[model samples]
Target: MPARYFTLEEANALLPELEPVMAELLARRAKVVRQRHKIAPILDDPHGDMGGAAATEMALDFVRITELVEQVQAFGCLLKDLNTGLLDFLSERDGREVYLCWRYGEPRIEYYHELHTGFTGRQRY
Candidate 1:
């Protein structure tokens, strides 16, 4: 299937939405790291009980954190791909004007013809 493409304006508008999602993902990663540090000291304490119910709870927490970290990483990667995949502008054949198209996941922007250069391209994606 052809990928869904966004206009330059549409893509630019999406940055606002993407930033928050990226921040949240980063925050989750930080939380996971902090949780890991907290659990590590507990595991290394030689004089404390480390093999009882508390250990099981810590293990479960670790598993949950790992899953969250993976999810956040995946989101970050997708954002990176989208950011890089988008096109800012392209010169038209006449050279008198340019067209803007975003191929975030579309087959191509050839179908979307623009009148001038920049984000004013037609929404043919």
Candidate 2:
């Protein structure tokens, strides 16, 4: 699929949407860490009689939390890439005004070809 490109104005407008999602993901990641810490004592108590069943449950929960953290970390990386990918007002080689693009779901900035670049110059996946 051809990637969608956002103009500076459009990208700026998207900050409001992106910021909250980024914040929520980061907060959730932190929560996951806190949860792991809380469970660590239970898992590490050498003398505590955590039965096989309880230990198994804790192990499963830890794995689930780790997976969630990885997912959120991926999202955070995407957000950071979008935030830092391109200059605010880039001038194309042809001297036309171009802006960095960061549409939803894009892995990274692939081009800043022209103000008219639109989806045409957008690298296809």
- Which one is best on TM-score? 2
Residue 95 alpha-carbon offset, candidate 1, angstroms: 14
How well does model 1 score by local distance difference test? 0.47
Which regions of candidate 1 fall more than 4 Å away from where they truly are?
Answer: 43-77, 81-125
For every candidate, C-alpha RMSD to the true structure in Å? 11.2, 10.4
Q: Rate the local accuracy (lDDT) of all candidates.
A: 0.47, 0.46
Error of 1 at 106 (Å): 24
Q: Put down candidate 1 lDDT per residue, 76-123, tens digits, no spaces.
A: 222222223433343334443334444444433444455443344455
Clashing pairs in 1: 3-105, 3-106, 98-116, 98-117
Off by over 4 Å in 2: 44-77, 81-125
Kindly report which residue pairs in candidate 2 clash with one another.
none
In model 2, what is the error at residue 118, expressed in angstroms?
23
Q: Distance (Å) between predicted and true CA of 91, model 1?
A: 14
